[model samples]
Target: MTEPGDPRFGATHRRFVIPTVISRATIGGSTCQIVVGVLSSGSATQRSQRGELRAELLRIALRGQGLADPCTVGVEHDANGAPALSSPHIGSVSFSYDGIWAVVAISPSEGRIGVDIQMPRRVSPTVLRRFAPDLATRADDKSTYSEFARRWAAREAASKAAGTGLRGELLRTVLPVARAGRDFGATYTVLDGWTFPALSLAHKD
Candidate 1:
């Protein structure tokens, strides 16, 4: 039987995998590429398997950018557990996964970029108030869950790009607006039926 890391046991062996270029958008001076795929189920060690899947996708993303040896690229995480390329800096990357879907965002420039995927779900008023008061104020009984998902994704992406990871007052302060200078800015788009909020931090001289 094939082990976990074997190419035959994971996404590499899947025939219906999505392409590396799901969508591309220009943020500031950086062009961010979004890559997405669906995860296979039935793994006894789901967490480790998912991590390996994500790493494989990152390698594919790096390879698309013309990296000489994508397999040698290493992913390092900050204190907040936000991932970055270890050395020979090709670009900045951020990713998120929900259910069976996973997505990766790559910025082929000095600017940092983040991406998040959120699925629509029931959110209570109190939970909304605590997490996203600005959105709560406009919330009504008829509110669509997709709106909340998008808002959550936007904030999460902003925090990831800022290297803060939703800590402290980040969720409240990081709005979907572009700040004056050297701040994280976010934009929302739908790729492969997933709503993603892509973030980019302007490079400071």
Candidate 2:
């Protein structure tokens, strides 16, 4: 709903929904915020065109923060592979793009942030068992898919924010359900009341 950018995703006349959220804070007299943008792909064609959508969203987000020449801002990776902004002011950036959708999170101050977005889809029981056997042991119901997706998203987003990627125990870790309050700036939203799979944004000091 926020003005990130718009590109029609093909889906038999159906409109793909893109939602953006900005969370703000202040650190050492500098304003800090994380902008999260999600793009829903309705068809294969639109999914393939996500690259442009991502870049445009990034540009818009930067410009909205009064950054100059956002389109030309360079993005680099640290030794741990977390993304960093080459320009000053903006601190760190992280994004994740599933085949069907994507989410980008940008931080405007000092700290690391990560984001992950996913469109709801069926998950094979076998696959779920491998990554999260604890979830597999639970009963099957309508909430099963949503819970699974959120747990996955939370784990991945946290991993990325930690700049550790998915290594060691994190690779197969299961995260707790998102709660209203948490430390380390951990927050997540499942848009449309779980109509969409999941969107998670977190930061590490």
Candidate 1 C-alpha lDDT tens digits along 146-183: 66676566666655666666766664553443222333
The residue-by-residue lDDT of candidate 2 on 147-186, one tens digit each, is 7777677667666766677777765554555532232334
- Model 1 bad stretches (over 4 Å): 1-11, 15-21, 43-45, 130-143, 171-193, 196-205
Q: Lowest summed-lDDT stretch of 10 residues in model 2?
A: 8-17
lDDT of each: 0.59, 0.58
| Displacement of the residue 166 alpha carbon in candidate 1, Å | 0.6
Give the clash count for each candidate.
0, 0
Once superposed on the true structure, which residue ranges of model 2 sit more than 4 Å away at CA?
A: 1-48, 126-134, 137-139, 180-195
C-alpha lDDT of candidate 1 relative to the true structure? 0.59
